[model samples]
Target chain A: MPDLFVGVDVGGTSVKCALSGPDGKVFHEGSIPTESHEGPEAVLKRIGDYVTFLTNDIGGRPAALGMGLPGLVDAHKGISRYLPNMTTHWRDVPAAAILGRQLGCEVRLLNDVRMATYGELIYGLGKPVNTMVFIAIGTGIGGGIVIDNKLRLGPLGAAGELGHQTIDPTGPLCGCGNHGCLETLASGTALAAEGIRLMLVGMAPALHDAVDGDPGKVTVEVMGAVAEQDEPVKQAIQHAAFYIAIGVANVVVAIHPELVVIGGGVAKLGDLLLGPIRHDVRARVGRLFPVDDIRIENSQLGSKAGVLGAIALAIHGLPA
Target chain B: MPDLFVGVDVGGTSVKCALSGPDGKVFHEGSIPTESHEGPEAVLKRIGDYVTFLTNDIGGRPAALGMGLPGLVDAHKGISRYLPNMTTHWRDVPAAAILGRQLGCEVRLLNDVRMATYGELIYGLGKPVNTMVFIAIGTGIGGGIVIDNKLRLGPLGAAGELGHQTIDPTGPLCGCGNHGCLETLASGTALAAEGIRLMLVGMAPALHDAVDGDPGKVTVEVMGAVAEQDEPVKQAIQHAAFYIAIGVANVVVAIHPELVVIGGGVAKLGDLLLGPIRHDVRARVGRLFPVDDIRIENSQLGSKAGVLGAIALAIHGLPA
Candidate 1:
C-alpha cells in the first residue's frame, strides 16, 4: 500500500483535516468541532479519533501525520507551549508524541501560519519561486518568511512576526500592548473599526444601507462590500493598504523575497487591495530592489493551505 | 604550508587587506589608497596590485581571496552590479574573477556589511550563538541578518537594508530619496544635522564651546563629546536612539535573533547608545522573546570586522 499522510489544522472554531497521497494529492478532507470547552485532553483525543477514522475509511493505517496548531509551538521539542486560542489548561502538551503513539506513525507539528506558508510554497503560487514572504492579513497580521526556499524560524521560534513591527511609534495602541504595530493599523479588526467610525460619522451611507444602519453590522465584510461603491470605505482600505505597503517595503528591504503572497481573509479583497499595496511598495522600495521583479500574489490554496502544508510537513520527512 | 586566506575590504578612499590562517586568525593586515578618481579599470588594477603585494608579504599564494564591496553585489555572479560610493564607471565589474586571475587563486565576493556580520558570527560575540542580527550604525544604518548561523542574503542579494526602512512616512529625506527612513532619523549624518540645528537655535552651549562656535565643526564626534554634559546634544542622541530602538525592536520581532551585534563608527559611543536601544527593544519585544535571552552585544572585532568577515567568506567556503 502507498504511504498515506493525514494533516490536521487545529483552530478555535473547528479542526480541519485532510488525507493526501504520497505526492500531496488530496484524496479526502473533513472537519470536526474542536469542543474545547470539554477541555484539552478531550480535544486532543477527538483529534486522534478523527485521524483514526480517516485512516480506517481509507482501509489503511497512515504512514505519518502532521498537525498545525494556533499556539506557541516548540517544533523541536514536539510540544505546544501555550495555545492562547484554545482552553486555558492547554499548556505544554506533548502533542506530537501523543498523536504518534495513538496512530503508531510519525507525527510532525508546525505553527498554523508557517504550515500554510509551506503549503503555498510547495503547492500554491510560491511553487514557482525560491524565496517568498507570506502575510496572512486577517483579524491580526502575521507572516511567514522563506529565504532560499528554507523557512527562517530564528532562535526564539518567533522570526516572522511581521505584524508586530512598529510603523508608527506614536500611533494607536495594539492589543499586544505596543503602539503603532501594523496589526493596530491594517488588520481586519482595524478595518471593521474604521468602518464603524465612518458609519457613526454618516460618511458611509452605502455601508449604512448595506447593513441597515446597524453599528454592530459594520463588519469587515460589510466594509469590503461597501468599498465597491463607497468612497469612504475605499479610503479606509487604502489607508490600511498604505500601512501594509510600508510593512511590505520594510520586509522587501530586509528579506528581498522575490515573491510576496497575501493570504487569509483580507486577501479575499483581491486586486482591490493588492493594487494599492503594490504601488506603495514599489514607490517606497525604489532602486533597493529591481522593484519590477518582486511579484505580489494571492494565496491559491485558500483554507486548505494549512492542511496541505501539514501534509507537506509530513512528506518532507519531518524536521530534525 | 597551512592555507592562508586574503581578505580585501575595498573602499572608495582606501583598500584594507588582511591575511588570515585557515582558522580565520589574522596574521597580517595593511591598507593602500584606492585612487578611484582614475576610474574603474585603474581602481581594479590597483586592487590587484595590493593583492599581489599582500601575497608577496605572506611569501606564498593564498588558497583563496575574498573581497567586500560597498554597493549592490551579486556574489553568485561574482559581479559588483553598482558601486554607489565609488567611481561612476564601476558597474557590473566581474571583480572576483579579475582579482582571482590577478592573484591566481579562488575568490569570493560579499557586501561589506554582510562580510562584517559573517566575521562577527564566526569570530566575535556571535560565535557562541546560532542566530544574530548585526547593525552598522554609522554614516548610514545598514544591517546583516543571520538565521540558524547562516547569513540570509535573499534573491537579489540585497536583503538587510535596514537603514532604508521608512519608520515615518513624512519625516526626513534619505539619500535613497525615501522620507522618514531610519537612516534619516538615526544615522551619524542625522545626528550631525540635529546637532547643527540645536547649535543654530542656541540650544547647545556646550557643543558651541566644543566646536569653538564653528557650526561646520559640529560633527558626530563633537556631538558625542557634548552629549556628555549638554542637554541638547544628549537629547539629540536620545532621539536618534529612540528611532534606532524602534528599528531594532522591529527587527527583533521579525527575526528573533539570539544576539544583536552593533558595529561601525557610531558604536564607539558604547553603553551610552546601547543602553537606550536595549531598553526600547526589551520594552517593545516583550513576550515575543524572553526580553532577556536576546542579548544585544557590541562587535568585538571593531574596524577589522569587514576584513575579517571577508576572511570568513574565504573560510566558510564559497557561496554556491
Candidate 2:
C-alpha cells in the first residue's frame, strides 16, 4: 500500500486539510471553520480531530503530517511565535508537537506563505527556475525565497518577511511597528483602506453603490469589481500597485531571482493588478538588470497553494 | 609541491594580485596601476605580465586564477558586462578567457565586491555564520549575499547589487538612472557630496578649513576626522547612517541574514558610522525579528578583502 501524507493549512477563518500520495496527487480535501475565537488549544484540537477522522475514513494511517501556520514560525522548534491576525495571536504555541502526538506521526511546520512557495516551487509555475521569490498579497503581504533551488529559512526560520521591508522612509505606521513597510502601502488591507476612504468622500460611486453605502463592506474584491469604471478606485489600485512594484524592484535588486510569482486573494485581480506592477518594476529595475529577462506573473495555484505546499513539506521535511 | 592559486582584484585605480597555496596562505602579493584610460586590452595585458613575473619568481604555475572585476559581470561566460567606473566601461570584455589564455591556467571572474564578500566569508569574521550580507560602502555601495554558506549569484550572476535598491522613491537621481537608490543616499560619494554642499554653504567651517575651502577636496576621511568635534559633520554622518540603517533594515527583513558585515572605504569610519546604523536598524527591525541575534559589524579584513576573496574564489570556483 502506498503511504499517505496529511497536509493542513490553518488560516484566520478556516482550516484546510488534504491527503496526498507521495507523488503530490491529492486523494481527498476538506475545510472547516477555524472558529479561532475559541483560542489556540480548541482550534488546534478541532483540526486534529478532523485529520484523525479523515484518515480513519480512509482506513489507513498516514506516515506524516505537515501544517502551515500564519505569522512568525520557528520551523526548527515546531513552534508558532506569533500569529497577528488570530484572535489570541497564537503566541508561543507548540503546534507541531501537539499535532504530531495526536496523529502519531512525524510532523513539520512552516510559515503559511512559505508553504505556498514550496508548493509553487515543486508543483506549479516555479518548477523550472533555480531561483525564485514568491509574494503573497492578502490581508497582509508575505514572501518566500528559493535560492539555488533550496528554500532559505535563514538561521531563525524568519528570513522571508518581505512585507516588512521599508519602501518609504516616512510613509505610515505598520502593524509590524515599522513605518512605510511594503505591507502598509500595498497589502489587501491597504487597498481596502483606500477604497473606504474614497467611498467616504464620494469619489468611487461604483464602489459606493456596490457596497450600498456601507464603508465597512469594502474589500479587495468589491474594489476590483468597480475598478474598471471608477477613476478613484483605479487610482487606488494603481497606487498600491506602484508601491508593490517598488517592493518587487527592491527584491529583484537584492536577490536577482529569475522569476517572481505573485499569489493570494488580491492577486486574483489578474492583469488589473499585475500590469501596473510589471510596468513599474521594469522602469525601476531596468537600469540594474535586463528587466525583460525576468518574468513576473500571477500564481496558478490560487488558494490551494498553501495546502499543497504543506503536503510538499511533509515529503521534503524541513529545509537544510 | 602544493598547488598554487593566483587571485587578482581589478579596481578603478589599481589592480591587486596575490598568489596563495591550496590552503589559502598568501605566498606573494603585488599591485600595479590600472591605468584604465589606456583601455581594457592594455590593462589586462599589464595584469597578465605582473602575474607571469610573479609566477616566474616562484618557478611554479598556479592551479587556477580568479579575477574580480568592477561592475556587472557575466561570470559564467567570463565576460565583463560593464565596468561603470572604468574609462572604457570594459563592456562585454572576455576578462577570464583573456587572462586564462595569457597565463595558460583556468580563470574565474566575480564582482569585486562579491570577491571581498567571499574573502570575508572564508577568512574573516563571516566564517561562523551560515547566512550573511556584505555591504561595501565606498564610492558606490555594493553588496553580496551568502545563503546556506554559499554565495548566491542568481542566474545572471547579478544577484547582489544591493546599493541599487531604491531606498527613497523621490530623493535624488542615482548614477544608475534610478531615483534615490541607496548609493545616492548613503554611499561614500553621498557623504562627500553632503560635505561639499555644507562647505559651500559655510555651515561646515572645519570641513571647509580642512579642505582649504575647496569642495573637490572634501572626502569621507576628511568628514570622519571632523565628525567628532564638528556638529554639521556629525549631522551629515547621522543622516547617511539613517538611510544606510534603512537599507540594512530592508535586507534584514528581505533575507534575515545571521550577520551583516559593512566594508569598503566609508565603513572605515567604524563606530562613528556604525553606532547610529546599528541603533536605527534595531529600532526599525526589532518588531519583526530579534535584532540582537543578528550582528552588524565592520569588516576586519580592511582593504585586503577583495584579493583574499579572489583567492577563495579560485579555491572554491563559482557558486552552484
Candidate 3:
C-alpha cells in the first residue's frame, strides 16, 4: 500500500508539489510554473507533471493526492468552485475530476488557507489547541478556522474569509468587492497602496528615489524603509496596524482561540508590524479580560505551509 | 425518577425560571426581581426558594438544576468568574457546588448569552443547524457561537462573546471599556445613546414632544414613534442598523452559518429595525456569496431561552 500522499499548492504564478508521509513529513518536493493565464488545460498538465514526477520516484506508492488553491472551493466534490486569479471564467470547475483523471489516483483538493491551518493544527503550534485562526496576509488577506481539529466549512464552505471581514464599511473597496475589509487595509496590498498613496502626496523621498519616481515600484519593502524614519509612511502604516490590531483583539474576544498563527508575506516585517499590533490590541482589549497569555506567532512552516496543510487535510478527513 | 430539569435565567434586574422536561418542553415558568443589590447570599436564598416553588407539587422531585447568568462564568466549574452588575462581587463563586450540596442534586451554571444560544440550538431557531451565530440585542449586546451543535466556550469558556467584535476602533466606548465594539455601535445602549444625543441636540420634534422635552423621556419607544416621521430619529436608527448589518454580514461571511438567530428587547422593533439591517447587510455583502437566504429572526422562546438552553446543555452532555 502507498504510504505517501501528494500535496500540491497551486498559486497564481506557481505550483508547489510535495510527497508527504503519514508521519507528517515531506519526503520529496518540487516546483513548476503555473501559467494559469494559459488556461486550465496547460496548468493541469503542469500539475500532472509534478505529481507524476513524485509518484514515479516513489514507485507509485503515494496513497493519495491533495491540491490546495486560493478562492472558493467545494471540497466534497473536489471542485474548484472558484479560483480568484485563474483565466477560466469558473462557476464551479470540477478540480477533483480533472486532477483525478490526470493522476489515476485518489485525488483531493481543498482551500489553501484551510489546508494550512489543518497542517498547523496537526503538526505545528495548533498541536495543543482545540481552536486556532490561521491568517495569511499577502496580496490579499485570507484565513482558515480550525475548531476541534476540523475545518468548520459551513454549508457553502465560505467560512474563514477573515481578511474580508469589514473593519471599516466606509473605507476602501476590497478585491472581494467589499469595502473596508481588514485585508485591503492591512495586507501587503494595503501596504503597497499606502506607499503609492504617500508618494502621490509627495512623501517618502527615499522610497520615491528608490523607485525612480514610479510609485508603482514603491513596494512594501520600500514602505518599511520609509516607515523607519518618514512620519507620513509610519502614520499610514500605524493606521492600518491599529485597525488590524483591533480586528485581532475582537477575534480573540469573540472566538477566544488558544492561538493565532499569522503567515504570508507581511509577517516578514517581524517586530515592525507585530509590535504596533500587539500594543494596540492590548490597549483596546483592556486589563479586565487579559489576553496577556494568548499565544500569537508567525507561521513556522513558512512557504510550505499550504502544501503540508493539504496533506494534513487528507489525513484528517478527505473521502477516498 | 424525575427526568425533568429546572432552568433559571439570572439577570441584573430579574430572574426568569422554567421547568422543562427531557423532551424539550416547558411545563411551567415564572419571573421575579433579582434584587441582586441585596447581596449574593440573599440572591442564593431567592434562587433556592424559587427552585422549591418549581418542584413543590410532589414533595419536590430532586431533579437537576440549570442556571444562566450575565457576566463571565466558569461553566464547567459552575462559578461566576466576573459580573460587573451582579452585586455578588463574588468572583468565581461556586454556586453549583453550594446549590448541589444544599438541594441534593447536580447543578450547572453558564453565561446567560451562551445558555440562550444553546436554548436556540436545541429548541428554537438554531434547530437543524450544526453551526449558528446567536445574537441578542438587549440593553447590552450578547452573542454565542454554536459549532456543530456544540457551544464554543474557547479554552477559558469565553468563546461566544460576539458582541465585543470590533466593527470600528474609533466608534464609541463599550460598557466593557472597549472602543468601537459591535455592542457600542449596534446594541440597545447605542440606540438609546443616539436617541438621547439627537434629542439633546434638538433634532427630533415628535420624539422631543413625546418625552415632553425631557431628555430622559426620549426612550426607544419614543424614538420608534419618531422614526415613523422624524428623519433624524430614522437616520440615527438606520445608522445603528447599518453597522449592525455590517456586523451580521461579516459574521455570515466569516462563519457562513445557515442561520443567524437575532433576539432581544430591541429586536422587538421587528422590521422597523431588521428591514434596514437586512437590506444594508445584503447591499454590503453583495450577491457574490448570497446571504439573502440566511435566516434572521426574533427569538421564539421569549425569555425562556436561557433556562431551556441550560437544560439542553446538561441533558445533551449527559452520559452520552
Compute the lDDT of residue B320 as modeled in candidate 1.
40
lDDT of 1 by residue, A1-320 (tens): 65789888887779999998888888898999988888777787899999888888788778988888865677767788777666554678888898888888988887788788888988898887888898888877878888777776665346677888999999898766789999899998898899989988989899999999888777777787779788989999999999999988988888788899898788888887899999989988876557898899888987788898898888884433
As for TM-score, the candidate ahead, 1 or 2, is 2
- Model 1 per-residue lDDT tens digits across residues B246-298: 88888887777788888888888787788899988887778544668888878
**Residue-level lDDT tens digits of model 2 in B1-320:** 44679999998899999999888899888999999999999898999999988887888777899899989899888899888898877788998888889888899999999889999999998899898999999999999998888887876678888998888888799888889999999899999999999889888888888989988899999999987767998899999999999989989988898899999999999899999999999989998878898999999897899999999889889877
Model 3, residue B61: distance off in Å is: 3.3
Question: After aligning candidate 2 to the native by TM-score, how far in Å is the CA of A90 from where it should be?
Answer: 1.5
- Per-prediction DockQ, in order? 0.64, 0.76, 0.61
Name the top DockQ candidate: 2
Model 2 off-target regions past 4 Å?
A1-3, B1-3
The lDDT-based order of candidates, best leading, equals 2, 1, 3
The predicted structure with the larger DockQ, 1 or 3, is 1
Per-residue C-alpha lDDT of model 3 across residues A1-320, encoded as one tens digit per residue: 56777788888778888887777677787888888877776687778877777777778565778788888887777887777766654557777788778777677778887777767777777887777888887777778787776776766566787787788888887767778888778988888888888787887777787788796687776777767767788777777678678667767776777678887777777767778887887776654365777767888886778888777765556522
Candidate 2 chain B weakest ten by summed lDDT: B150-159
Assess chain B of each prediction and give its TM-score.
0.93, 0.98, 0.92
